[model samples]
Target chain A: MRPFTVHTGTAAPLRRSNVDTDQIIPARFCVRSTRSGHADSLFADWRDDPGFVLNRPGHRGATVLVAGNDFGIGSSREYAVWALQDYGFRAVIAPRYGDIFRENSLLNGLLTVTVPIEAVEEIWAAVEADPAEPVTVDLERLQVRCAGNVTAFDLDPDVRERLLHGLDAIAMTLREEELIVRYEASRHPALPTTR
Target chain B: MGSTLAQKVWDSHVVHRVATGSDLIYVDLHLLHEVNTPQAFDGLRAAGRGVRRPDLTLGTEDHNTPTIGIDRPIRDLDGRRQSELMRRNCAEFGIPLHRLGDPGQGIVHVIGPEQGLSRPGMTIVCCDSHTTTHGAFGALAFGIGASQVEHVLATQTLQLRRFKDLDITVTGRLPDGVTAKDLVLALIATIGTAGGQGHVIEYRGAAVADLSMESRMTLCNMSVEAGARAGMVAPDATTLAYLRGRPGVPQGAAWDAAVRGWTALRSDPDARFDTSVVIDGAALHPYVSWGTNPAQSVPIGGRVPAPADFADPEESAAARRALDYMALQPGTPMRDVPIDTVFVGSCTNSRIEDLRATADVLRGRRVADGLHMMIVAGSAAVRRQAVAEGLDRVFAEAGADFRAAAGCSMCAALNEDRLQPGQRAASTTNRNFEGRQGKGARTHIVSPPVAAATAIAGRLAAPADL
Candidate 1:
């Protein structure tokens, strides 16, 4: 995972709410064992329509997505995050996000910014007015800057620290090997074990 | 302060605590299914890592497995490769898997509880969002992503950020014809989709206590749809009865001791919660979603709501778009809406009790002409139980297709069991998102009884209506 510190990229405005993972990468496209090819299937259901925002002229190479409330609302599939990253999106800015989707994005290095609806509206306005308007997401500052406006966002400090460095949470977890082994020794005997 | 049930389970599992941010909690059980998880195994191999505790992990073939014609090799190339990879991966890791055609093989969530892998006071994580289903036994369970799955596979632990506690009290007995599905749908409607954001909900009160173990599982399974981190009901006699003599349950004296311990796992009366919601359960009717999202629903006897009925601009816009996609007219009675298909299966409501409820409704009835109905069980155990009770005969005689094997038949369109472009279905699945059943299928989420009743009426109708 590449560390996400500060990124400035062109924006694509998606004026839709509850944009679930199913639509991000449909179930049919989720078959492949690998994760990279999802870029082609991103929004596979909607891309056929010429009027879809991603297909619009100026938004072609966007690396930031500004969407409505409740983004990534369904399915725990991390493929949704991979699809966005595969499509060159460094981050996603939304008013709200599904709890699981937010965690998935953090672990996979896709920055999920939870800004106020007003800030989301402001960013969308800026992108619609000028499709190539640069949006800056500063993880170090916990802020988003676009069109001369600075909007603050909130992320758990631990998550921010982990993202600042490319995290290996499993390795970090393994550092407490002694504690884990002790706890396991005393765990309930009634618990199920595949062994 | 008095500790809540969620707090008790969470605090008990902490192997190590970080200074001010998170806790390294021990995971008791890690369930795996064959979808979106192949990458996790690939990562483990690349890093030269082996599973830390294969004893605590179990895998199954569910999400993408074929429900019918499964006796032969899986016909779909993609589905076959996934199953093969799952068999090989579990074998390589030395983890036990309930493979295809195995008696224990079924939906991961369903078989876990049936085989007693999901019991009280344990911390369980799976890659599927419906993992909250195990919380019915008072366990702390939630879904994780691919990276977290790998984290659990490699270390058997998860770095956790805390969630605020939400206490949802459902008082009074549920009305007749109202099942757990309807009760949960009602709760989600009261609290919008994002209402439970970043909170763990502990469902309690007389109404919840009266529910069966399977009903409690149904309630917890859809907690994710309401945007909750997880949902739980404290273990009780009902939970004990369900776990007695199941596969992993301890024997005789050991079981008694386990019961004594689980009996103590409950929220104190004075427990403090960040938020509270109270619902009068007796007043809830059989709910059926009219639009795309689960919250966009109303009582069975009510009419479809107009967009103007919503005060929030975003909700109003969403309602309008939902109506357009649903092809439904405002002011139309819900019972008047026609459905071309009826599907009764999913992690949400595919247990034996759910199947029994569907069978009770369709016993002497026939599916209406021109309607396609498929009744899939949650597990082979559930399927066999249904057969012993003659529910399969009831379904077949009613012109409904009772599946031979248990898998996620049509809840998702992972295989050939899906609707065509523009077909509308009254489904018991947890989701009704656009194209969920298939490419252009519109789904109205309902309970098992409601699904069976709608199948016979050829429209959205409650059993009482019939």
Candidate 2:
């Protein structure tokens, strides 16, 4: 996992609300042992239309995505986050996000910043007016900046600290393995029970 | 302050608490299936760590296994590989794998409670979203992502943030022909999808307490559809009776001790909740999703809602898009909407009771011409029970495809049981997300009786209409 602190990149504005994980990457494309190649399947169903924002010119290579409220609102699949990161998005700025999707993003090193809907709309307007404009997301400052407009965001301080240090969940969980073993032993106190 | 049931279970499971951070909570049972565990197992192998508690962990091949063909290899290549990987991983990790032909093999959520692994006062975590089904037994069960799955496999613990308590109180008796499915759908419709976000819902009041254990499971199972990770019903004599002689349940002295402990797991009379809502169960009709989301639903007999009915611009736009995708007219009655197929199995409603409910509606009647209806049992045990009761014969006689066993089937299009592009289906599955069944496929979520009646009519219909 890479530590995420500050990122500056072109922002892609997606004006759709309730953008579910199903549309992020369909279930048919979720197969495969490795997590790579998800970029090809990112928004695969919506890409056929030339007018779709991702397929339109000037949105290519954008690393920041500004989407409407309730983004990534279906399924517990982590593949949604994988596809976004694989598609070169370092961060997603939305008014709100699906709880599971937000957790997946944090665990996988993709930053998800939540702000007021008006703040999101401001970024959307700025990004839509000038596709080449770069947006900055600073975890240390807890703010998103674009075109002289800066809006503060809120993330749990613990999550921010972990993301800043590139600490993976498995390692953090393993640190408390002894305590877990003791707790388990206390709960089911018997011989090696085989089911 | 009297703690809620969720708080009781959560506090009891806390192994370690970090200052101003998440707590490390012990997982009493961890469930997994073919699709989600591959990456978790890979992570464990990469770390050179083995499963810490194989006895506490259980695996099953459901999402990718076929319901129709049990004697042969899975025809879908990806499905086969997933099932095979699950078998190998479980075997290597010393975790029990309920393989394709195993009696216990079924949808992870169904078999958990069926085998009594889902008991009161337990903290259960699974990789699938519908694991909330176990919460009906007074367990604190919820779903987690792949990384969390690996975390549990390695340490038998999960880092957690406790959720606020939301009590959904349903009063009054359910009207005839109305079921738990209708009640849950109505709740989701009233609250909208994200209404329960950040809260663990406890279904209470007269209506929820009156339901059977299976029906309670049905109600809790769809909590995820409403953005709630967990939903629980307090254990009582009903829950105890349902757990009496199941596979993993205790007996004699142990049974008495377990019952005593479970009896104390209910919320206090004066327990306070962050939020509470009351629903009139008697007023709920057979509900169905008319749009791409579970929250966008109407009663089976009601007319499709116009976009103008929504006051929010985002909701209105979503309604319009749903109308386009579902190919529905705003003012048309829901009964007039035709369906090409009907699916009668999923974790949401695919128990023995569900099959019997469908069979009751299908008996002495035939599926309408050009309509395809398939019924998959929730598990092999459910299948055997259905067959013994002659439900399979009734389905077969009614011209419905009666599958012998369990798997995800059409609930998720992980195998061959999928609808073609632009095809519409009346499904008992939870989600009606765009292309959830298949690409370009439209799903209208309904209950077992509604699904059966729709198949017979070749259109959306409730049991009363028959």
Candidate 3:
């Protein structure tokens, strides 16, 4: 995981809303056991069209994705988040996101910025107007700036702190192993088990 | 203050309150499948950590397994490798796994309850989003990503924020043709795709209480479609009856003590929620999706909605896109929408009761000429049960293709069973998102009976229409 303090990159605007994980890296690509080779598979179906946003010459090297509402709306696959990072995307800005997708992004250090629908439209306009214009997503300031217009975004405090530190949450939880053992002994007696 | 069922379960699992503003809660069970778990194993190996509680974690191969040919090697190279890797990984970690040929092998969500592993007041997590199906037993079950899967495997805990409680109380008896699948579809249609985001829903009132355990699982399975992480029903007589003789359940005096606590898992009479919604169950009909997402649905008798029907510009635009992708015309009767295939199985509705009810509808009917209908069980165990009940003969007699093996066939089409380009299906699967069944495949999400009737009618027709 990489610490996400601030990032500035060219933004690519996805006009469609409710882009699900199945569409993000289709089920076919999901078979690959490794996570690093998914860059080419991101939006594998849509990318076949020459006119797809990311396929355009100007949007070719973008590292920030500005999409519509309910982005990543289905599936709990972290492969979707891995595909974005594998494709060099540093941050994703959307008005709304699937609860699980947002959580996956936080753990992987891929920043997800949520703003009002109006602010998202503004960012979309700036990026669509000039694909070369770089947009700044500042985690420290809690704001997204594009085309001299600044719009603020909100991130959960719990997630924000971990992303800022690039923390491995597994290690943090392991530190409290004693507490976990104690908690287990007190679990409901009826809870089922496996041999 | 009175606590809701979700609140009680959630509070009971809390191990520590972090200064960083989230609760660190212990996980009682963690279910794993072939997809999205190989990376987690790799991470665990790299960090030199062993599974903290292998006994509490269970793995099963389902997503990429074939619904037919249980004896042959997996044909897809990538899928075969994934399956092999999973076997090796589980072996290395000393975790028990239900192999593809084993009777215990089935969809994780299905086997969890069947094995009596999902009990009230427990906290369960899986790599698949539909893990919420276990919440039907009054457990706080939800899905997680690979990183979280690894976290739970290593430390048996998760750090997360709390969710607001939403009470969805359905009144009156559900009409004959409208099953739990329809009820949830109607709910999602009323509340848009992201309606329940960040909330945990407790289904209350008469209609919910009347549903059987399988039906309750069907309702909770699609909670994610409404953007909710978990949906639950308090444990009661139906839940107890289903678990009484199942393996892994508490016995004798232990069971009595457990029942007392389970009975208390319900919401207090005066419990307050962040939001409350009441639904009229009698009014709902068999519902089906007209577009790519679950929320883009309407009753079987309704007509396709025009983009203009949506007041929000973004919504209208989305509707337009969905209509274009689905190749549907506005104002067309949903019953008249033709389909190329009909699928009657998925984690959502592939249990013995579902099979029996759908079989009753399909018993003497003939599948429309040239239209294909397929029925696959949620697990090998389910397939065996369906066979013994003669549901297979009924499906075959109805001119449908009843599969011999069991897996997530056609639902996800991850294992060579899928719709081709320009193909459309009336399926019982949870999602109707673009190409979910196959590349360029369009789907109308329906209940098992609706799928059966649609197959016989060669279109989207309910049993009542027949």
Candidate 4:
């Protein structure tokens, strides 16, 4: 995972609530042995429709997905985040995200920005007016700014730190391994026997 | 400050809480499945490590095996290789395996509970997220990744940070038609899918207390949907009664002592929770997801929401997208949404009880023309019981497609059973995410009776219609 700060690229409006992982990366595409090749398959069915937002020629390189409320629900498939990353999306701006998907995304280094529903609408409107205009997601300030409008949201401090550092849950746990080892030794004198 | 279930389980297992804020928690039971076990086995092989406690570890083939044919070789090479790998890994590591052809073979979640491996106050870990289903027996169960699987296999312990407690109490008697499925769906819909994030939810109150063991499993099975770490029900007579004389549960004097310990596992009368949500069971109706997410649900009689009614334009747009994907028209009654298929099996609702419920609704009825209905039992044991009770005959007589054995069939398209592209299904499975049934397959999460009724009506029909 890269450690660069996220600056939301041009916003592409996709007004859909509850955009589940299955829609993000269909189950068939998930059959790949390696997890990295799913980007091209992201929204495979929907992308074929000329009317789909991501398929529209003008929105080709848009890196920020401006979506509606209750996005990324369904299975805890990590491939959904991988597909979004493969599609070149650095951030997903929605009012809320499916709990498991949100955690999966954050753990995998995909930026899930939760703005208020009003703020989400404002950005959606801005993107709708001009699909090429960019929305800036300042990681340091934890704010989203677009078309002279600004909104800030809270991220659990631990999750925010892990995202900024591009560390996974395992890595975060491993960082405290020494302390864990010492604590285990002291607390479980019979640890070897259990093993 | 009184202890919560999460705290009680965590405290009992914690070797130590270090200054760096990590603890070594002892793991009692480790469950493994094909999809994620290969890498863990490889890691162990590479490190020259043997499974620390093979007796405590259990393996089953579910995710990659073909649900249709147990005696024949899997035609899907990839699926076959995954299953083969689990077989070899388990054999090499001396871990007990419930292979596809064995009567013990079934979904790991179902097998563990039915075999008496999932006992109260135990800490269980598996490679699959739905492992929380074991928490129904009052154990602390959750999914871990492949690396963690290897870690547990080698060390028999997990490093962890404990979670806060959230008590979600559902009071009052459930309405006649409502089941545990409705209660969980209602809870997720009320709280939104992320409402239980970072919390270990303990299902309490009259309605939850009265649920059957199988029903409780269905409730805890979807805890991941709410982003909860796990969900547990304190063991009571209902739990003890279910465990008594099971294949592996303690016997005689040991059983009495086990019950004594389990009885004290409940939250103290004055126990406080970090967060609390109260629900009225009477208000819950059989729910169906109109959109992709479990939270995007409404009562059977409700209409799909019109985008324009949303306060946020973005939310409106999202609703529009979900409708487009689901092929549903806004403001349309959900009952009117035509379904091409009805599936009544999954870890969520494929037990003997669930099968019996579906049979009850399907008796003397036939699936409507053009609808493809499938009933896949959760395990061989469940299938055996259904057969003995002649439930399979009822399903067959109703024109519903019935399979002989069990695996995670239709619930996910991991095997031969799948929905054709653009197909719509009413499924008893937990998720209704787009393509969950197959590529471009649209699913509506429903209860067993609703699934059976929809199969009969050839659309999204209510149980009351029967």
Candidate 5:
């Protein structure tokens, strides 16, 4: 994972709420033995239709996806985030994200930005007007700015730190191994014997 | 100041707190499956570690093996290799293994509760996220990754952080047609799929209190949908009754003492939560997902939402995209969405009760033409019970495909069974993600009755419609 700071790129409009992992990378894409090379498969069916936003010529190179509420719902597959990253998306702006997907995204260094529904709409309209127009998502300020407007929201500091540093939950836990060992030593005189 | 279920479980299991704010927590039960066990076994082997406690660890083959004809060797070489690897790993590590033909061979989640290995006030971990299903028995259960699996295998312990506190209380009696499946769908619809993130949800209130053990498992099985760490219902008479005389549960005087300890596991009356949501069960109706996500759902009688009406612009766009993917017209009644397939069975609703429910709908009826319907049981045990009860005959008579048991079948298209491209299906499985049933397969989440009814109509329909 890279440690580059995320700058919101062009906003690609995705109008639906609760965009599940399945749609992000259908299960067929998951059958591959290797995890890499899923970018082309992201939304393969939908992207084929010329009407799909991602397929629309104007939206080419859009890295920031502006989506509806409750995005990324369904299955705990980490592949969803992998596909999004492979597709060149650095940030997903929505009213909310599926919990597991969000955790996976943050762990993999994908930024999930949440803003008020009203602000999300404004951003959506701005992107729809000109799909090529860029939206700036500033991690330092915890805000999304585009079309002469800026909206700020809260992100759990722990998550922010993890994403900024490209650290996953396991890596974070491992980093504090010394503390964990000491804690274990103090809690039980002897580890409980398993049956 | 208030303790969440996660906090309560975390506190009780903490052996020591280190100055760096991490803790070493004891793990009570470790569930293993073929897909994730090989790597852990290799790690253990490389580390020169023997199985720390074989009795506490349990393994089963579900992900890689075919659901049908356990006697035959797996035709998929990759799958066969994975299964064989697990067998070898377990043998080398001295862990108990339940191969495809074993009586205990089933979904790890289902086998744990059925055999009474999943009990109240225990901490269980598995490589599968749905391990939260064990929490139905009042245990603290969650999924860990392959590395964590190896660590736990070697040490019988896990390092962890606590989650936030949240309680979703569904009060009052559920209406006659509503099952635990309906209740969970309603909850997901109301809270959105991400509502439970970073939290361990405790299902409380009168309605939850009234559910049976099987029903409780259905409720907790989908906790992953809500982004919850786990969902637990405190043990009561219903839980104890379900566990009594089970193959692995306590017997004699120990049973009495176990019950006493289990009884005290409930939240105190004064216990508070950082976040609380109250649901009136009476208002809920059978729900089905109209779009790609579980939260993008409506009541059986409701219509698909128009993208223009959305309050959020991004949501409006998403609605349009989902409408396109699902091939649904705006403002069309969701009940009118045509379905080409109906699937009943998965870890979510493939138990004996689920089979019985589908059978109730299929009895004396036939599935409509052009509709492909299949029933896959969660386990061989469930299949045998369904056979003994003649549910298979009813399913066959109704023209439904009564196939042998398999994991990730129609639910995920891991096997040969799948929805054709551009075809829509009504499934009882946990997810309706894009292509979850197959590449280009559109899934509409539905209950067993709805799935059966849709099978009969060749489109989405209610059970009463028949």
Candidate 6:
């Protein structure tokens, strides 16, 4: 995972709320190949319409996605997060996110910043008014700034630390191997196997 | 202070806690399926780590296997590769795997409890979100992403945060026409999609206690629809009776000790929760989804909800979008909504009890002239039980298609079973997300009885309506 401290990029606004994982990347694309790029499959159904925001010329290279509340609502697949990163999105701003999706983002070093719905609307309006304007998301300071207006956001401290240090969870857990072994040994051998 | 069942199970599993971060909790049982395990195994190999506790981890090939053909090779290239990869990965890691031909092979969620592998007070994690179904036994079971799957495989633990407890108590006897599926649907409909976002809900009260183990499993299975990854009901006589003779269960003195432990796994009488909700079971009918999301539902007798019914602008807009995608009109009676196909199987409601319920309804009734109805059992064990009871013959004689049990068939269209464009289906699956069945296809989430009646009526009809 790449360490993420701060990133500045053009923002693309997705006005629809409850944009589920199925819409982020459909189940059809789920079978293509493991560990392959899914950029082309991102929002495949929605992209059928030429007017979809991401398909428009101005947002072609946008790297920050400002979407509505209740984003990533269904499915626990990390493919949705991988698709966003594959499409070059470094940060996603929403009023709320599905619990599992948010966790996946944290582990992969893709920054997910949560702001008030009003703040999200403001950013969307600003990005729509001027597509060329860049938004800076500073994780170190916990703020999202755009068009001379800035909004402070909140992130779980542990997740923020993971993103800041690019820590690998497996490596960290391995350090406590003895503890795990002892815990396993504590369970009575007379008990049935949990499997 | 007394602790809720969730807190008790969660606290018991803690291995190490960090002051600035979450605790590392030991995972007792890890379940695996084809869709999410392949990439996870790849990650484990790349990192040069073998499974820490292969005995505690079990693998089964689902989500990509064909329900119609068990003896033949998988025709879908991706499905075949995923299944093959899972076999190789499990073989190399020394994890016990139940293959397509194995009677124990079925949907991961189904076989876990049926085989008595999911015990009370245990911590279970699977790649599939519906793993919450195991929580019906008082275990703290939830789903995880592929990355978390790898984490559990390597360390036999998961990084975790405590979740708030929400006790949902359903009182009174369920109405004659309503089933446990309807009760869960009504709960989700009342509390919107994200209502239980950060909480673990416990289903209890008079109505919940009266339900059979299979019915209780159905209630816990759809907890994800309300944004809760885990749902629990304390184990009692109903749960113990269900597990008495199942495989992998302890025997004699061990059984007595196990029962004592499970008996103590309940929430204390004075335990407090973050939130408490009470539901009247008698008021619920056979509920069905009218829109793309599970929360967008109404009773079978109710009409479609207008966008204006939602107070929040975002929710209103979402409802409108769902209506558009579902091609449904506001104020239309749910019973009048026509369906092109009826699917009576999924991890949610594909057990022997579900088959028996559908079979009772279709024993002498004929499927509507031009409509198609399909029945797939939850597993080979379930299929065998159904066959011994002559449920398969009842389905075939009633003009419904009876197929073998495989992974996730129509629930997710990874196999040959799928709805085509512009087709609408009444399914017993958990999610009704856009194109969940197939591209341009719409799904109406229903229970098995409702699905069978809908097939016979050629529309969305409840068993009482017939």
Model 4, span B205-318: residue lDDT tens: 999988999999999999878868799999999999998887756678777777787888988777778899999987788888887768778898999998786775554665
lDDT of 6 by residue, B137-244 (tens): 999998888899999999999987788899999999998868889999999999887877878999999999999999988999988788886999999999889989
Q: Superposing every Cα of model 1 onto the true structure, what RMSD results?
A: 1.0
True contacts kept of each: 0.74, 0.36, 0.77, 0.18, 0.25, 0.54
- The superposed Cα distance between candidate 5 and the true structure at residue B55, in angstroms, equals 4.7
A18-47: candidate 4 lDDT, tens digit per residue: 676667877555544444667788888688
Off by over 4 Å in 5: A1-17, A32-41, A46-71, A82-95, A105-195, B1-4, B15-25, B34-55, B69-95, B143-160, B308-312, B331-335
Per-residue lDDT over A63-93 for candidate 5, one digit per residue giving the tens place of the 0 to 100 score: 8888877777665556577788889998889
For model 2, residues B1-466, the per-residue Cα lDDT tens digits are 6989998999999999978667888888999888867888998999898898898898888886777767889887766777788889999999988887888888889988888788888889898778889999989998887878888988888877778899999999999989999999999999888887878899998999899999999999999888887999999989999999987578899888778888999888788899898999989899999999999998988999999999998899999999998999999999999899999999999999999899999999999999999998888888889989999899999999988668888887877788899999999999898888998999999999999999999999997888
TM-score of candidate 2 versus the correct structure, residues matched by position: 0.98
Q: List the residue pairs that clash in candidate 4.
A: A15-B317, A15-B318, A16-B318, A17-B318
Better of 2 and 4 by lDDT: 2
lDDT of each: 0.91, 0.88, 0.91, 0.80, 0.77, 0.88
Q: What is the alpha-carbon lDDT of model 2 when measured against the actual structure? A: 0.88
Q: Please tell me which model should have the higher lDDT, number 5 or number 6.
A: 6
Give me the candidate number with maximum DockQ.
Answer: 3
Ranked candidates (DockQ, high to low) = 3, 1, 6, 2, 5, 4
* lDDT score, candidate 3: 0.91
* Worst 10 contiguous positions by lDDT, candidate 6 chain A: A186-195
Instruction: Please state the CAPRI-style docking class of candidate 6.
Output: medium
Q: For each candidate, give its TM-score against the true structure.
A: 0.99, 0.98, 0.99, 0.85, 0.83, 0.98
- The candidate, 4 or 5, that scores higher on DockQ is 5
TM-score (0 to 1) for chain A, all models? 0.97, 0.95, 0.97, 0.88, 0.88, 0.95
